[model samples]
Target: MSSAQGGSGEREESRPKDVEAEPAEAAAETSAPVAQETSETPAAAPETPTEEPTPADEPGQAAVTEPPAAMEQAAAPEPAPASEDPAPPPRAQPPNPDGEAKPQRTFTPDFLTELFRNPLDPGYADAAARKAAGNGAVGVPKKILSGVSALTLVALGFLLVVAYQQTVADEPARTQARDTLIEQVQSRRENTTDLSARADQLRSEVARLREQQLGGAALAELQEAEAQTGLAPARGPGTRVTVGDGPSPIDPVTGERSTEGRVRDTDLQRATNALWAGGAEAVAINGQRLTATSTIRQAGEAILVDFRPVTSPYQIVAIGPDALQREFRDGVTGKFFRALNSQFGMSFDVARIGDVTVEAATEPNLRQASPSPQASVRPTSSPSEGGR
Candidate 1:
């Protein structure tokens, strides 16, 4: 019995040991679950995310998840959008609080394209075309100005020409009238008003005719006798002179001066000299006698002979021996006339008159008469005065 009891005691000690080992093993297994839970808690905490996380904080998750999908999409290339403007929406937007819809912009692209394509504008294409074709600007402004200027000049020239023409047209008539006037005045100057000697001669002729109061036959004989006497009629040998103004000096180019042309004083003097050398007894220019008091002066285009105005076609009358006059005209003076015709185109005419009678120059009239003495006492003494 004592041996049995020793064995039981050894078993019991061993059983205690095994029991303690079991508990220890169970504790180890339980502790292993707790450790696993701790590891899994950290992973769940990341998923639990207390707030939104930034990309940097979730980098690892982002890389593993979203990045793979994005990378795959990126691998396929995409085309760029076209430059065309976006189309408008089908529906219009609601009006703003102001009750007005926004105005849409309308493009004028078509109009602009047409305008640019046209070649008529002031652009490079038009300029280039004109240059290549060697064309210049042709329009209204230039032509109008040129035409107006030409017309104005033509009108002005016409006016000037007309004025000159009028002056010339009146010259010939004026010259003729002036010549006539000068002739009358010169004749008056040469005539003397001395009547005393003429009255006495008239009384003597009356007394002689009265004393020859005879019958018809006797009267006829006395008349015949008187006729034979030198005093019966007036007769004399005299020269006839003619002075005339010549034509205007010939224009060297045109060969003759127009009506408006000027006459020279020198030409007048030359004509006068020719007449004198022609043996003219007495010469008168215009109507003025070629006396010492006469002078040929220039007054404008006309000439003045002894203060008497003379125009063209002046005539000088001379009285002298007809033969001598004929010789004078046909001699050197005639040669001069020929030269005048050929060189200067002057006109002249010479003629001889028969039975030329020249009256002597008379004394000028004196008008300052003295009052006649009262004839009351002389009336009775007229016969008594002759006796005394």
Candidate 2:
């Protein structure tokens, strides 16, 4: 029984030793396969100059040595043949933790040389040299620039054509609008003239009816009123005066024709006043009868007589006694006419006519006048005067 116990103890101690030896054997097996693989591969064969030293015959030595050999094999990759394989392209570095890529650097010998060159040196010579050498890198390609310019010009031309077409399309509407406005103005003028003629005819008819109702005295009164109010045409012996614009004068500074010497409203007014002062009974200017309310004025470049435009040569017809021509020739009008002729080179002519006719005046609008009730009432006598 004592011998049996001692043998069991010895066997238990040997078991631990066997366990440790098993691990070493496994490591050796793994390393042998790797070494064999390296020898077989042509790429890794050149690096296998000498085999890795095996561990010494000591406990735990194989485990330590095996791990280092494995690490070295992993660290040193096998090199590929230069002739059969292409060089790998440069790999981009990873971005920062913030996800921002780093800026790349560009370096050229010419750029570096220019950066360090002195500013005092002449740069024109270098520019000339570069231009003469016809370096393609100096500027953009001519073909590309020309293509861009052509595209820009084509776009501009297209826009201009579109604008012109739009204007042409709208032309008919614009012309129609202009013609409509002109027609409206002409129609209004014709309507005014027709209404004036109708009013004059009605007045003449009323005067004729009054003449028939109240004979001799009333008829004479009506005739006198018509003459005074310029409602009846006048035909009598009169003096005729004609005035015309002077020739256009040359501007000394601009060498252009000037209208300064032309007849004006003031000149016409002066001539008319002088004729009235010479005891003229009836007067008419440019075929327009002059009444109490008649006005001689200017509208733009035109002369307006009684709100009607008249052109040169203006003719003044006056009916008076046979001595009218003699009186007017010796009056202020004759002197003014002489002055105008000499100063402005205007045309002024006076003639005596045997019989001259003057047209009736435009009807005046009586908007505010009302018949007087007291005027129509007969005068009443007191009781004492009635008894007598």
Candidate with best TM-score: 2
Q: What C-alpha lDDT does candidate 2 achieve relative to the native structure?
A: 0.59
Query: Could you give candidate 2's per-residue lDDT for residues 63-159 as a string of tens digits?
Result: 2222222222221221111132222333433332322111111122243333243121222222222233333224687788789999999999999
Deviation in angstroms for 170 in model 2? 11
lDDT of 1 by residue, 1-388 (tens): 3332222222112111222223333333343233333332222211111122221221222222221112111111111111221323324333333211111112222444323432222222222222223332335465886899899999999999999999898898899899989998877655533355665477568747765667578766664444222123223343443434345555799886663233356655765576556555555554455553457888876688756687766665565556755675677766766566565566666666665433222222224877556555667557666776
Report model 2's TM-score to 2 decimal places: 0.49
Supply the global lDDT for candidate 1. Answer: 0.43
List residue ranges in candidate 1 displaced over 4 A.
1-264, 355-388
Error of 1 at 125 (Å): 61
**Cα RMSD, each candidate:** 46.3, 30.9
Report residue 366 deviation for candidate 2 (angstroms).
3.7
Model 2 ranges with Cα > 4 A deviation: 1-98, 102-194, 365-388
